[model samples]
Target: MTSISTTSSPATPTTVASAASKRVADRIAARAGDPDITLRERVALRTSDAEVTYAELSERAQKTAAELSALGVGAGDIVGVRLPSGPGAVAAMLACWHVGAAFLPMDASAPDAHRDHLLSRSAARAVIDGDGPRSLTDAAPSATGSPKGDDAYVIYTSGSTGTPKGVLVGQDAFAEHTTAIADLLELRDTDTVLQFAGLGFDVAQEEIWPTLAVGGTVAFLDSKDRALGPAELARRVRELNVSVLQLPTSYWRLLCAQMRGTESPGLSFDGVRTVVIGGEAAGTKDVHAHRDGPLGHCTLVNGYGPTETVVTCTAFVLRAHEPLPPTAGLPIGGPVGERRLYVLGADRRPAAGDSPGELWVGGSPLAEGYLNDPQRTAERFHADPFGSASGARMYRTGDLVRRHRDGTLEFLGRLDNQVKVRGYRIELDEVERHLTDTRGVTAAAAVALDDGTGTGGRILAAALAVTAGGPTAEEIREDLRGRLPSHLVPGLIRVRDALPLTTSGKIDRKAVAAVLADEHTAGEEAGAGVRVRADADAASAGIAAADTADADLTLLLKLIRTLLRAPDFGPDDDFLAHGGDSLVALRVSGTLREHGLRLRPSDLLTAQDARAAAVRMERS
Candidate 1:
């Protein structure tokens, strides 16, 4: 049993079992799911269309278990739970553990191939919401259930090679991690947490179980609500009385920016007590944005962890009234729960408090390892040299970190090809593999860069080498459209005669970035259109009128170029196809307001690109 060094306590301590000794299903049942225990007659889950009480949810989970049992899903079997993030999905996941089966959670937004591959890789005994023996939501119960501390879930992540790798997480580890997070978050029965993350993401587990463990309500945002801008989301939070929220760093930034400029009617984060920001390096710019906005009064917590190490290993809490830390980046804070943080130097010895080195995690939160891949498991998870405890293992996290004298950890960049784009961890090698898979592609490399689009932010740019007269950039993009998710699609694809290589004969990512930057600069200089001015007033007040287009329309085109961050797209090109989404539309709305224009996200959604959007805006 380990204690987190936090002094905050909302309730008396209970006799919680150590992760090594108990099953997660049993712990969840005793702590939250079982109606006979702390679970009183109260709303456990809620969506826009429906609400379920704790008792009803428990019954649904039991029914789901019976359905799985009917499908022959028993001990040691893997069941794929594919559903949108809702009460039904949560019940299905619990049902897997109820029947002693490992669950594979897939994102509803994931491409068909990705979902198929995961189900095929796991050799899933039964699939939910797909072509499977039985649906988890279809059936009442016999109470025949079993729980184990073995494999609980398999999460697929981008691999260094072509295909994705599945990471196997055990029930005990997940239980300990979520419980520890709940304790750290000081979750109570009064708290209402919004289920913000996608169903497949590991953080969803943190959002769900912790609230349930404390008998708190879990509020869910429907797809329409999810697609709404920051103002709308904040309004929902206020209306629902959502006290806790976990948002990705990128979306949080967008929200902070939205609140900084305008005051939406009855829209504010006044009720949100704790906001945990993770999935990517929480930008300092966003911190400044929030500090000056409506969300300034809420508690901002910066959490850091990879998929390999459960949801979160360290947390840095930023009080609204406190001055920002003097550190270059937000401190990742110290170890949580039964976890130990070791910054090992080149010699595999512990680095000094101020020195930068590879960070290793040794803890109960450690996953079982990559599913069906022992070689990678052996490479990353090794015997903990610094630990005094025998049989202890440490994961060789390729991230570099520095520990301050005050026992706080600061995150440095990654040591490998892995990069997080809008909180999605992507291995550049995997993108390259996909690029090369395209017809006539000889060599390919992908890099994340700060393309000039203010709304879209950092985008995945790629450089490709192909045979003479090979597929065009648009053609390749169209080909990849069906194979990959929108986030994985490259915003800019520059065809090269051959990809540059280093002296060691490896793909030169830096050179590729330089080439893209140079080409972008050249394109901006050569293209004849309304050039965006540095001053917001000049750009939005009105750009120089073209002979062919109106002055306002020219200004609108410039706005589109600046907002979308794509210089290559024509007036007819689809905005979304060029990496623009509803979140980006929010930014566009904010920017438009600064220079005496008004446009809503819904209005912007009606148009396809620059010409259409501009026309629609004018007519409106």
Candidate 2:
């Protein structure tokens, strides 16, 4: 799946703003060449029951916008949007855009703790919900005409560093980048774009505005239906005649699974134009391969971008036989029209050709800064060393990239405390945040170590002291399950007597990694550890053999060790005295699944300890 690009080749694209509205909308109108056009595209949505039109979408967006205004939502006010993807989420986004308000989208599926942190951190004037936030304010003056920069909104990332930080994107930034996307992709009014990515995800920016701005139609797929598998997705695409499809690499894998020779096994993009794969690298191998099959007539572009920049900093189309070089893809093409990019080195020196450097994004599309957190803003958004003659500020991407011998750019790797897991960038602090939230926890710390994934080992937590009724390792994990996405959660939760800190008072990550290495090595007495004649317990032994009795004893031992989180606890350990939690019990059950074992995530939590849990597992 190594498909990240090194540099952006596209120059920034800009368009003259109309007398009213916002920059993104303005750019779309100009490119569309038809202000009178009611819908962005000419596609119709169909299903077993009925057919839908863009007019319906317009009515809903307009209605929602009007409703929001009555609720005191004005241009520029930070609105924390945490909701699922569907017609409601789509309408809310367009409604926000229609009135020229900035958008701040958060993943609705995240844990409550994460959501609470985001809302508080962003200090959003208002938070949008289909059911409305628990609190509300009186109506404010309704904006009648165009929106200004001060009125624009910004979306915040689920701060993996500890809390969420808002990325302030305004009307101008949206317009600047999208206009180039339209030109680069040749998006037209006849195209129907499917909005599959979560509003919290950047792919929405690429999927939503480009189509709507061009007077093209946008279709919001229901999340429920979205999980129905690829065959069903093909039906929706063909029925809607979706011309432009943009999806995250995760979703692409599922979609690709259902696809057959150059086309979907049961369907084809008869009217589709382009298929966009972005957010994360779409493995160069997949891109090069899928370019021709069912994609027959469609153009396939593997794009790249980071959270700090506008939607996309760069992109490259996969051409037959002329695939991207091994380093990554070509640079984002010449400022698609209004924006520009600079590859700066460690000292912020603009790197020469093929020279690696930090990616600094500048131009009119830049964000003002992080919401509420000035220190972070100062660190990331630096002054224009070239001078403020252009009033241009650049965001340090922390991504190592370089220019190609040609004009294209290539991605190197990360230079900071960030790493991507299952396509999501995670900060070690975010993991610590969730751990500290657990009861009985005094101080928690995490570190990324050597793991199979290229990003590094990842943030694993260790609690130094336990508060009265302090949480167990499993409790911390379960807590995170509700606040962060699964991928952001650590693969292992190590309970320690205490965390090690440096002279500077920061968590000693090195000390934590050492613990992790010891834990994995000590616990893994891998292979056939015991002679189990029965198919019973293999939990404690970390050993599995074909013989039933041999596996049973091993499973029992493994379950006890896992539930206890005590390296020396052994198979005879008393689960309760060992401090077992529900999550640890669940792990015991999950391990069974690896060898065809299944117990509920709460299995161990209900039991007193390993022996009892083993009894339950054996019974089940």
Candidate 3:
């Protein structure tokens, strides 16, 4: 919340492209066989399952590259690496670079259709798994050196349309971005960076290459570790002796909540020197929780940037010396390296220092642009008017932010319908497109709402207009589940007679939100199926007392109320319809555990309504 202090002027837009851009394989291989380096003795990566050394990583990558070559992978080709987040995936990505091929990392957890689109769209030469390629061949790594302009990796993100767009980043741009990250973090060989983000995400580039570029250890969290509770995450941090940790703002808050008491509960912040939180707007509640708590000993940094900008183009480091400002939003800070950020008004002119406007980022770290889509590339990437380099471009970030007189930039919201849910960028129009694709759906619209209370504060809600014989909401949801990733699937679906329209005949989103809110309020007042207190029952308010016959139901209702912070939701009203998400469901499960009751989060999710959830609890 405190304003970021700046000492340097805004960096120039010109990026001195590396004369010989270093490839991932070349940089990591630098220390591989060096007698003085002894990479075999240094731990390169650690996961919940096992630890791998730098020498072992290099050998594996080389072998994988050979296998890929046999599969027809060549210079300037794209190879799809569909593997989970870990050392194996990292090795495969590096292997592509070694073979003079660009790699596309597809999320293994994504739906088959999503993965299929990426592989097909990229025209991949081959696919690689973590175990290695399907077979070993007599193919060899290309002897031709990689040029600075050669493609490195293509990462896909949500687009304004229904499909995801791949951002083709050049090796020079990637190298520059990673180097800046390493310098900003002051990484060292002794430092261990956690690689928790999915490989499909650009942040994984920040987590892996930056650490490896400095000869630092890259630690990965296994599937279980990724789902670790607050207590477990803190304990693991201590056990791993991790010095640097970066987590999404929401997850960081959950851990900070456990550290709020005077006595440290589970996490020991002794080894952690810096904690970088980003991916979305950070909450002041989290800052207050950690600023004076156990994490006060460590430094906290707020980073901001779009995937098109590679990683973080700007960062604000929070020090113990300065007090947090009494504000809701945190400053994104000034540009780093050769990156330059401009706040332009609606007229595309630079706004006043303190005025709100769209953020335009110009720099060398900017991506080459969307792969195979020249139209979108031109729409978003514009000529760098202030750049010294000829034909240099800048990306138009739809994010709206305000630059203060002190040069600190604070995020407001988006200029478009794009929203980030659980650190995943989502385009509402994309979701609506898919929704309308469902059979019988005449029209559809999607809206993202954030209550800023639960773990998954952002929820995608969709409204549909059907003529007749339309697929049921459940059927539509089921159809979407197969075509889209879980994160893109709307948590709530409402079927309406017709989508409310404005005077211009366009769908009125504000009207839809108002209707939803009013429905929730009316549903609460109607009581639905919620049990009422008996006339003589003075011990309980709306629910029964702890020792009552319906104690389980009472406890469940109260827990749901606390999780949603919505006292008005009736027993029959769907929890999700009232803004319950996976995070809130997890909290409900934990509360049930305290009562010696067992109810799976999945059970509650499927049940939807409180009455059904109670039934599931009774069955359990």
Candidate 4:
């Protein structure tokens, strides 16, 4: 019931909910059937294998809608989408909107238990996965008609209770948010926006909906391309002629590093006009690096918002040749569109002057609250005392920030244990809960430790107290891999007789982090010794049966050790086993390319170890 004010036009009328719900889908359909051949024939979606025109995408959506209708899905029904990031996934989402049904995006790679829990909790009527649409329930569909104010989509985020909570966003909010972003980015029919985020992430909506609403092409990278390092990613961007990029702050840092690196000092963001970075605080150093590096010609925007506010509510746009703001770090600029920002202090009143306070977001961007969880809904979403409109509510984002004299916001920190690592929001308590639930685990503590490479990357680490004769740390880690997502699992796990406690009797997270850091250092030293001994033995034995193969293996081992920061990594050591993840694999590929060798992330992941990967490289 609140109105948002935009620069190009007045605020959307409060009574536009029903009309707004139909605007996005209606606009896309109109473009598909337009008399102008250019509009209808324009590329709307691009995958590795094919490019779909606006008309083709519309037809696919219509067919998928019919399939959903046959499965008893209609207005008010929630459908789970588990497809990968491709044309099929985009069509499935459009189909839900066409049939007046809301959708819940689920990760295709998530464990069965996790997926089942979401399906059961959201009461999804049907699910569309690789096998296509199938009924998940036998209930009758709601009467067919306009969806009106029905919920648009549900996105689940990590919860402190160890269960993911679904945030229910209505059709009006989704439309308003996407339209605002399209306006902010000045998206056009010729612009190609890269679809980089996972389907389940809220950022994915920003990538897909806004582009379609403006008739721009949404380019999706294949798995191999998606895992590319900054140098290779820049090349892919040029090949696709991508004009826009929405990257996480962590990955953006990597891009900055690549541009400044001696190996690829000229790696360029050639065709990209705008780069949006969010999901974590942007550091001052990274901003300066981008400004002074090859990406200086492109616009850099620092976006900020919680999932409850629909991807991003505020943005700080820094254009080419503009001087940096005088703030310590990049400021998260004023609210975008009609959304309003409120910096409330401990007394629940607007913070005076430049004082820090909790950020509260209001207006059309506010979500309907958590699905099927009234207690949480009431706790976070409250009536807006600052708004003049009756029934207007605001979402209380637990992030702490300060308001500058120019109305821009500077991020300080968090009010809770929520941490963002590699753009993923994680609750430390949720990770600890899973650890304690593991077999033979008595107590557990989770902390975000610095990666120690001065790269601003944080590693998720856990320290646990296990019973006598319980599973080893490796076994516990393996078990966790089956239960949690790769990003949620701790990179380093330590077993202790008992976790250190603070003076107040709470878990001493600082002390535990110290122990883990020390152990990490010791391991690297021991690994160096082992590498020296192995090299000596090879020299003494005159093991030169395969000179080329040995040299390849040696180079592979060195790269693995340097990238993973595991100096003990050997020719037979598994890359993943030594804390290598997809990001690291991308770096591996980029480094290998520098040496006149090539390997995709999938290729590295499938190989048995460094030795096997070297052998495969040799064959190629």
**lDDT top scorer:** 4
Candidate 1 per-residue lDDT over residues 214-308, each given as its tens digit: 77889998765435566568777876679998898788888786678556565577788888988777656678888887777788888888888
Residue by residue across 427-528, what tens digits does model 2's lDDT show? 767767766766777776665543322222222334445666667765666666666655566655677677788999887878877877666455433312
Question: Which residue pairs collide in model 3, if any?
Answer: none
lDDT per residue for candidate 3 within 117-165, as digits (tens), equals: 7777766666787556642232233211233327888888888977788
Please give the range of 10 consecutive residues that has the lowest summed lDDT in model 4. 1-10
User: What are the lDDT figures for the candidates, one per model?
Assistant: 0.73, 0.58, 0.73, 0.79
Work out the TM-score per prediction: 0.87, 0.72, 0.85, 0.90
Rank order by TM-score, top first? 4, 1, 3, 2
TM for candidate 1 is 0.87
Error of 4 at 462 (Å): 0.4
lDDT for 546 in candidate 2 is 69
In candidate 1, what residue range of length 10 has the lowest lDDT sum?
A: 7-16
Error of 3 at 326 (Å): 5.0
Q: What C-alpha lDDT does candidate 1 achieve relative to the native structure? A: 0.73
Candidate 2, backbone clash total: 80
